[model samples]
Target: MKQKMLAKAVGIALVMAPLASQAAVENIQYFGYAKWGNIYTDNDDHNNGKGERNDVIRASEGYGNYRLGNELNWWEAGLKADVWQDGDAYFDTTLYLGSGESWGDVSIIQMWSAGHGLFASQPNAKVWAGERFYRRHEVHMIDIKYWDTSSTGIGIEDWDLGFGSGHIAWMAPNSSADGRSLHNIDARISDIAISDTADLTFGLNYIFTQNSSYEESDITTSGAMLSALYRQAWDYGSNTFAFQYGTNALAGGLMSAEGGSNRKYSTGVEHDGYSWRVFNSGDLNVNEDFQVMYSIAYQDKNLDNNDGEKWFSVGARPQYSWTDYMATALEVGYETVEAQNGAGTNDMYKVTVAQMFQAGKGVWARPSLRIFATYSEKNDEWNRGGDTYGTAMRNASGKDSVDEVTFGFNVETWW
Candidate 1:
């Protein structure tokens, strides 16, 4: 208990340390997020919860994006700086290194490479996968990333891209049983073009990995992903229209554990005045014997099979702004995933809603409140020819699917 409290204190101190610089710089700006929340998992044991529990508060700074340094000149020079939380662990630093350029703006330190996926995908649908209380997970490792934006010349704005290489380990210690240590490297490019009604963006990434546990020890595996997005604001008097599409693919060794090649496609559309959006994601397992090896124990297992699973999801999200400081949002989604090999199949349904309010610019320094809820179900069936298998997998923690209500306050600023 004392150790946890001490860690919290240290975190608070580190965050405040940057505030001291605010007094000296004329053009410096500071901003961040701080909140206290709890977790009540239906499957308490799923995320190493000893038992039913209540955590007082968990403070998070910037979600995962970190801003480290400031540029004095538009495209002449600047330094690298950032201090943000990765899950529960915080990385604090303001180092001026790796200086360069692509189009116009000066480059600081390389944070993201071109070889890794660019988009920010959500975690698993499970809460346990969504929350990280005390562990520092999802740390970013960049081999080298530099950017430039002067290529567009005066009046026209260009984009900045980066290239990097490094290995991806799930956590700090790399403890997964089926963990693969590879000499993988990826690159990324973003902020392409800023036009009146249209913008273009693209990214490509590749990963090469190896599993030492295999009999051959030299299992060279590789995968790549490409993404392109374009959004235009259409003027229809009181309303507007926008659309987006993205696709990803994984081949080679990554397909070994899951069976075959892995591919996913997603697209979304929204309107200007209307606070509603429609989107869909489709996943396809190209191999018949690809299985994902997961465990409640966090242990690795042999995940080879004679069948595969393919699923698709469709959802709608609508939000309304009651006042400049108050709003309400609702979401409904349905997804179905199935494996064919005479083994079994699983299907799921989900619905969620949230009402949020703010006192001062969405900050709790004065105080704000948000209410949210979600309900989900998973039905499983196993039938091999005329033979019937065991029952489906269910939440063993004794609670139905899972339910919870989160209430919290945030205190921070950005400039």
Candidate 2:
């Protein structure tokens, strides 16, 4: 029901945001992002959910989160207000809460509001509506994101289209899988600087299947995707590259375009697909007690049934400081997946070495306090244990290769 009336109008606008900001709220702000962790693994053969080293040696499932102590007990916090104004025309609002993996389960995940210069010839345009996570871009050491078009309908964005900077939205999807009745549209033309440190963007995502019984054949319920991104900045860090293409029903936007396809849309020949990626992580301060944070990724996925996947990943997380709050961090990661219908290649390698007590000194300093130990090695066909003795190990400690050892502690913060 329109997402329960937009969650009851975001709970009545956070309960009328302090009586509507005491009549025309001027400004308000608060923000947060967090990560919490707990991991313990030591090979508990079979039922792979207990030793849960995130299902034994991670990364390669929609590929993101490349095991850097893979922290994921998420959190987000928010507030941003600037209620009512009229000159440049204003209304601004933002509210986020988010939390996952328990903790009394919270929710909100942004509630929107926008108005900014309601067109006096597009005074830097803005016009918005509820629920959003729009404009997202990330790659923080394989934490993945390369443009997002989060949903909940309604949009219009920064328009200074002197060549770039434009957007569009019209969501309505929150779920679907044969339950049909979907619609999504996202478009963009971002940044576009292209020099003095580069910038460029282009995007599009379209989905359709507003079934009325497909209204008499609608191209088998359309789907489209196309994307491009390129960024470069170097004073220390910044690098990203992406490319995508899709067909048929891509409903899940684009996670580097799909290689774990279970998607079967019968006729339409599985709607061809392709993806691309490249990365270089952040905070590369190479001096002053050594600092680093690196990441490299190469992705290739071509879908149409089964048989197409190619992924390569590389990781880094070096830190060395014995002063400014103590430090020592070492994280190494490796990944390989090459399949072309033969189940022929698989690889995983990890190493985590931590003992830090940080707060400041490169690597985006953080609420760092880690005490870790991790070790990994894989390729027991990457543990596919459907056993009865179909062997993915664990028939009386069968195995040849498959190893793990983990111990964790992590805490991350952002504001």
The model with the greatest lDDT is 2
Off by over 4 Å in 2: 1-27, 32-62, 66-79, 83-90, 93-132, 135-153, 156-205, 208-253, 256-302, 305-307, 310-338, 349-368, 371-411
lDDT of 1 by residue, 296-387 (tens): 10001111222223333334344455665675545454444444343344444444455566553211112334555555454545322321
For each of the candidates, the C-alpha root-mean-square deviation to the true structure, in angstroms, is: 17.6, 20.8
- Tens-place lDDT per residue, model 2, 238-273, is 666666665546522345222221232211223335
**Residue 212 lDDT in candidate 2:** 33
Q: lDDT of all the models against the reference? A: 0.27, 0.65
TM-score versus the correct structure, for each prediction: 0.43, 0.32
* Clash totals in order: 23, 0
**Candidate 1 residue runs with Cα over 4 Å from true position:** 11-28, 33-180, 189-195, 210-214, 217-220, 235-308, 340-342, 359-368, 382-415
